[model samples]
Target: MPMPAQEIEELIRAGIPDAQVEITDLAGDGDHYSARVVAESFRGLPRVRQHQLVYEALGGRMGGALHALQLTTACPTEE
Candidate 1:
């Protein structure tokens, strides 16, 4: 059971509140995805930690419903 892109985006937004996320299914299978997330919450966190936070938002679905995620996280840029 692959995770839906909307579900993954919802989870990330739930955790970060103000995340701007773009999701793509890399394998044409919902199980493999690529996500680019920009959030204010990432301002102080390391990239690894930011990724972990997003993974945690998935609630243990990483190895099961969600197979692989190529993620890019960043703090919102100053305008």
Candidate 2:
């Protein structure tokens, strides 16, 4: 079974309370998705680490309930 976009968003929010998450279904199949996540905690992290935070938020859902995710992560800009 495929995962719901809302579920993915909720999961991320639960893991990273301050994160801003946007999820897009690329294939309309619920099996593929793209997510953009921004958080203050990511400020000093490397890109690889930023991505890892998102993957961790998914709680090992990759390659299982969630098939694939194209993720982009960043820290909020200072004003």
Candidate 3:
């Protein structure tokens, strides 16, 4: 079975707590998704590390229940 977009967002939020997450089904299919995650905690992190955090939040589901994820991560803009 494929993962739901809401579940993905929820999982990210659960892991990042203060993150703002946006999930989109790029192919209109549950297996392919794109996620944008923004969090204050990512401020000083490298892009690779930021992506790792999001991957970790998925809890090893990357190749199983979830097929593909195009992820974008960033710190919240200073405003």
Candidate lDDT scores, in order, read 0.89, 0.94, 0.94
**Model 1: per-residue Cα lDDT over 1-79, one tens digit each:** 8789999999888877888999999999788999999988889999999999888877888888889999999998899
Clashing pairs in 3: none
- In the predicted model 1, the residue pairs found to clash are none
Reference-based TM-score of each model: 0.92, 0.96, 0.97
Model 1 earns a TM-score of 0.92
> Candidate 3, after superposition: displacement of residue 59 in Å?
0.4
Which of the two, 1 or 2, has more TM-score? Answer: 2
Candidate 3 matches the true fold with a TM-score of 0.97
Q: List residue ranges in candidate 1 displaced over 4 A.
A: none
Candidate 2 residue lDDT tens string, 1-79: 9999999999999989999999999999999999999999999899999888888988999999999999999888889
> Tens digits of per-residue lDDT for model 3 on 1-79?
9899999999999999999999999999799999999999999999999999999998999989999999999998887
lDDT-superior candidate, 1 or 3:
3
lDDT of residue 25 for candidate 2: 100
35, model 1: CA deviation in Å?
A: 0.6
Worst ten-residue run, lDDT, model 1? Answer: 57-66
Determine the C-alpha RMSD for candidate 1 after optimal superposition of all C-alphas: 0.9
